[model samples]
Target chain A: MQIPSPYDMIAIGGSAGSLPVLAELLEQLPVSIDCTMMIIVHRLKNVPSDLDRLLSLKAPITEPEDKQPVLSRRIYLAPQNYHLLIETDGTFALDYSEPLHYSRPSIDVSFASVAAAYGPRALGILLSGASKDGAAGMQQIIAAGGTGIVQDPASALFDTMPLAALELCPEAQPMSITDMVHFLTELKMSAEHDQ
Target chain B: MIKEISNEELETLVSLIHRQYGYDFSDYARSSLKRRFQRFMGYAYIGGVNELSDRLLQDATFFERMAQFITVNVTEMFRDPLFYKTLKDLVLPRLATYPTIKIWHAGCATGEEVFSMIILLQEAGLLERCRIYATDLNAVSLLKAEKALIPLKCMKDYTQNYLQAGGMEDFSSYYTADDEHAVIHSALRRNIVFFQHNLVTDQVFNEFQLICCRNVFIYFNRQLQDRVLRLFYDSLAPLGYLALGLKESMMFSEESIRFEAVSAVHKIFRRKS
Candidate 1:
């Protein structure tokens, strides 16, 4: 039997035109995937967010508390304004520092921290957006020997984000929503076999 | 160069600061500290974490500069309007009865929120009786807070926030401005005692009727949060009020039992009498 994939975390970063894709991804993913799922989507800072409540319809999506445990089998969404950071010590941290790439919870910030924490043991996904925020982040993942994937530019509502990532990480895999669902299924099965 | 920092290197750096400068960052959230250290590296033109730590140990002034960078200072006047309004309507009247109203603004970075609090006290006619002690971990920030010079460009937004916080008078009356900045009127500064106090290592200095430490606990780890909760609980007089950041929860702390929620939505709690 092929060796089961030992991935423990899957980080997804997107901005404009990504929310619908997230909803679809959540609706399709299995009920019991045992990896820490982190999603960072750009949203207004001060406005109250229903994104968690909206996404929770598919699965139990949550916003992490500072120093919250990075337990697996849960979906963690970034809060509105604060940068969500992953700790190498198996926890999460929040920062209210200045915005980068015109964003508080910058894709680059979270992905850099994610890359630092998980290295090759993680998967990074970049989806539809109009900005250049996630490109450097995806490159960080690839440089750390992690798997980098992007939603195929053809399938993205806005191709700029995925295309930018591919430009930086030429070797990153590009997949459609169907392909991503299949990839996640195989990932889940691989984990089941490993355990 | 694209890689973010690791905890091991950061731990060494933090311990080095502790050993040499007596500035303890052991209880702070490591990820936030690591991010700040990375920015400090860029500012100082240092190459890596090992070198950063080496330079800090080798040069005391550089370490001070590094300390300045590590402390997050994203603050604005009346940053959260509703918090102030709620205090004005709900918390202040209860506090006004005290013979000498002692209020502590813990981790009051740049004193914007402290200024807002003072405005509330003034409106309620409690400013004379209130003795406000505003403290921050960074001396540089404390100095800025003492001066109360806010950027002139931000006044429009601050004024809007003041209105939303139920201020009837013109917010501009609070400050006089230059081309670049607005220095808050000196009268408001009369009762405020500014000082440097480290929440991580410092012991409780005084008891107060209200301790406003919003958005500060977000930088602390769970253990440190618990310890600071104990400090706040000890420093608060019986039935004294504690206001925390909207996201902060003291649920797991031993002091949690000692504080009853005054307003869970506002993150206000009162010490058990």
Candidate 2:
């Protein structure tokens, strides 16, 4: 199998049953990882206030800076009432102006931006979530020559987002959290080998 | 049967648009172009696509009305505030290093975004060093942009956006409110030059440190998007920044590989080596 290079950034989007899967994935990944990780989890505007704290249990979590430079190995979570975007200089931004897809922290907004900026260097991972938010974005990632991976719908806690992504891009890899971690580890190792 | 619009009808409509209007819908996504044109025909009280095509050839007034329907002119002041804020905080620092800056607001409809950038550059103390080229495909929209005014009711909402995007001073200070209109301050308008430039048929005119074309390309097909992205790529200085709408992506475009993500969440990219 031809493994893609180590990604500059990994953007994951999920909602509903994603908390456990995200926790599991973070726990398995090491802090020494070279890439930046960004996650957007859909929650009631008020309820997920402690998302930074929750994700920080496994990885260092920070609220994205408006136009701040992108830092590697840190996990950035989308703040409430803001859409997170990746800028060209490897920084993060938060927009609180309006909501797309009726959600402030829209999956499509973040994923599409990643596909645009990172192109083939982007890795998009879609997990269990409600609705079809990330479907169109995943297609964009694939079309941009980025690698796309989704949690298996059958294995997902909430199958909607994963299933929607699968429907949109049939060739996307569907893996369990353990397998996904292994895949990323191998990807990193292969990248180092090539270098 | 309802979907069966004859080839002759399609050909006639395409020819009418090219000849009479001098606007080309020939290369637009077929299904979406057809749907929009059909709706335009119905709204204008014309009899179907073929008749609408013929009427366009004869009546200049109908063509003017048709242009409005065909153009996607939706825009907002500081529509993506965080992106503007990023330009202020991150990109402006780099732009400040230069003695002069040229910024382009491509596809600037009605000038809300152009004025928004003007306000941002002013706040950053870069306005005096900057010259903004605000261009759009629709001449009607360009005229509106040149007016530099917005509805008074929208001021409250835009003010809120300005604050959230980290406005250091009062939003009211930037505009003068009279009756139902807010005239943008003359200081902010000094460096802005408004013109009509189509991304599809136009060539790059100047190199820019920052180019903002937000919420516009989502209406375009992939081919057009690629064409516009190339135009932007050619227009940007090396290591210059490109900011797009939240939903717009440079993926599938030739320029995608030539830029790096500065901020993934803000949809900001910088030209690469």
Candidate 3:
């Protein structure tokens, strides 16, 4: 099912074995689409996560600075060891709050903030992961009248996160990478036409 | 996720707080304030935003209870180790030239960073010549910081941070530990004077060669940040150093502000005379 409004903000959660799928989604993003996108992947606290550098082959990605503005047509990676919160003023706030589900940059925390900041215009996508961190965040998005998309559990390498999100938001049917890309492009086109 | 207060209710609550208690939270970042409001509601077992506001309006003591959540933020001994390392390498050497040094640590919540700074000073052989003033708005936090204690379990990580910051000696030697806590050695606590000062409502109290108010600005909006930056500027001695968190900036305020970034990467600035 297609969400009616063009997504003003999008948050994607990934962990375990979701890197390749995340890369594909970012790579296939329509160039004309203009919105803020955040990528949250479960990473170790002290470890060097150059996820942005790895994913920046075609899509230029940045690890946002504290209280940095959330500009359109740019992608952000959740900085390591900091819970990334998007404030309502289209800026980011990073804090060292306690880890949720043993993950410092918990997807749930960001997703909840997105739900609060964007309400119905927020879009959340849950991909492969080994933990249940993003499930409640997806629930929060759905509860706030936002659209949630789950990676097909059958296709996920680690299906735990996708299945967990599906349990909370059954209306968010499993979507394959190609199908998700097609749907996003169509939404971008619709929004552009309306303008 | 808990329900957040509406923007209107949030504004009313902030205004009510300022009017009743004279603690100005009017300029705090609304996003962080909203998050704290949700936490307060959960703590008080109040369901709706109106109910929470009503309870605070009725009970004087409840606002005191709410202050604890608003203040008393988190800190570790050596957050962002590289920032500390830069302090040792670049900042401290110039500070040693003085026969006596005065340093002010604003928003020194629980004094972890104060302890960290003291350790650095002690290593540089400048502790004897230095007088450090550490202040926070929360009385309970000031009392805790005066005790010079930390959780014993956090020592391992802090030790790693110390080593990365080019620690000259063993970090374990600074504290004595039981099963639950590690009390810092009394010798290391000699130079610091901890007190209570509010960044929002307080004015400049003393001039210092170095002033640090790190990571505290993230809780404030741009206007409040500018106000606090001006306070720090007035509190600094001419050509004094002002250190901030990695991403915090002074560029948000007026155009002719008199400080120049000496090390933008480390968030260290110097007053231009």
Candidate 4:
């Protein structure tokens, strides 16, 4: 089946083994893409580093600000020690009250929030990571009538995250990062066609 | 990989809980229950569900412990600050037109969201005209909500959220700090009611202008999400609002087309005419 296009937002979740894969995926995304992107990568809480600087090498990046309006073609990273959630009016919010599975910037929280916000209009992609963090959130995305995509375990740097998501959401499509990017670009094109 | 529990054993456990005890787990999503059971087993130092079941039957303490395990009690105050901020900036103004308002916090765990809503309403000058109903499946969390006492350490984080969500007053003014706990202002609590209500089996008891159920559906399956969404749709008055957790949505449900998105990212929806 041709997946729906014009996704309101794209939510990507990853962890330990995500950097290289994230870099590859970001390189594939065109600067002219017109959808908001929210990325959740598990990280150490107190160790201050610039993910924006890191991601900027591959794509334009922005950190979600409280109540700031979301704009297209910008990559938004979940801040350290906070669960970044998308707001209804197309802005971003941060919650730092507690940690899930001993990790802040949890993939589950971000994926789950986006699943709720965009429903079928949301696209959830799980990349390489350690642990089963994004599994439940992928299930949430599917349960909310959204599409769930995972990097093919065979190609993933660490198969744990994609495997977990596949285990939780059996219908999730498995693709290499290149195929996934092509698929999303085609989706955007098709959505524009229909519109 | 987590050891897979047999379906028969899972069914038997659910049946026993329903027959011997008043609680029902039969309708809960199987995967979620399994994950929680595994976590409970690990936490209680039991080998698996069979041993955990035996302990639950033999020891009341174990049953209580299992209760905590089964319920997804994860929550934080002003969880999606922008959602609350949107309610304050966008929705409350319309709600203020009404002389009186009734809001429900369905699946409210430990009352943080309820208290947060009260604080929002108080700041919006709507508290005097509002009566809030806060319900949750867990009684322990409800009791905590009733006490209105949360750890003082949590105050700093919550205060930050309050400010980020666009608070007009000092965050410290909402509570009084004791040794380790902060007592929420009684004035905010006065118009609030706390009760236990299970979303799976319970029916809507009142019409509401706004109903907030955040992060509670991640523990439920698709059927249950649809069921609960239908319940919320039925519970809402015409043009009323429904807010869900960042991960929860009403897509594919019968009510999906019946409500228009007020804030899609915040999962806020307004009832259609």
The per-candidate TM-score of the B chain, in the order shown, comes to 0.97, 0.91, 0.96, 0.93
Point out where model 4 deviates above 4 Å.
A1-21, A25-40, A43-101, A104-195, B1-9
Cα distance off (Å), candidate 4, residue A113: 18
The full ranking of all candidates by lDDT, starting with the best, is: 1, 3, 4, 2
- The residue-by-residue lDDT of candidate 1 on B1-273, one tens digit each, is 524666677788888888999988898887778888888788778888778777887898898888888899878777667778888888999998898999999999899988988888999999999999999999999999989989898898889878877887999998999999999888988999999999998999999999999888888888899998989989999999999876677774676898999888678899998
lDDT of 3 by residue, B155-221 (tens): 8888988887778898988899989899999898988999989898889888899998887887888
* RMSD after CA superposition, every candidate: 3.0, 10.8, 3.0, 10.0
Task: For residues B230-263, write the lDDT of model 4, one tens digit per residue.
Answer: 8988999999999876545566456588899999
- Better structure of 1 and 3 per TM-score: 3
Q: Could you give candidate 2's per-residue lDDT for residues B118-209 as a string of tens digits? A: 88888888899998999988889888788887999888778877876778888898888899899998867988999989787889899999
Chain A TM-scores of all predicted models: 0.94, 0.90, 0.93, 0.90
Instruction: Tell me, by lDDT, which candidate is best.
Output: 1
Q: Please write out the lDDT profile of model 3 over residues A122-144, one tens digit for every residue.
A: 89999999998899888988888
Compared with the true structure, all predictions reach lDDT values of 0.85, 0.77, 0.83, 0.78
Per-residue CA lDDT of candidate 4, range A1-195, in tens? 232346768888888788888888888764455677888898754233677798898887876644456777668888765677664446555554347766777888777667656888788999987788889888878887888999999988889889988988998999998898888777667766765
Please give, for residues A1-195, the per-residue lDDT of candidate 2 as tens digits.
333346878888998799999998887764555777888877654222577897898877877544456777778887665667764445454444346666768887788768767888888999998788888778878888999999988888889899999988987899988888888777667766765
Each model's TM-score, in the order given?
0.90, 0.59, 0.92, 0.66
Q: Flag the better candidate by DockQ, 1 or 3.
A: 1
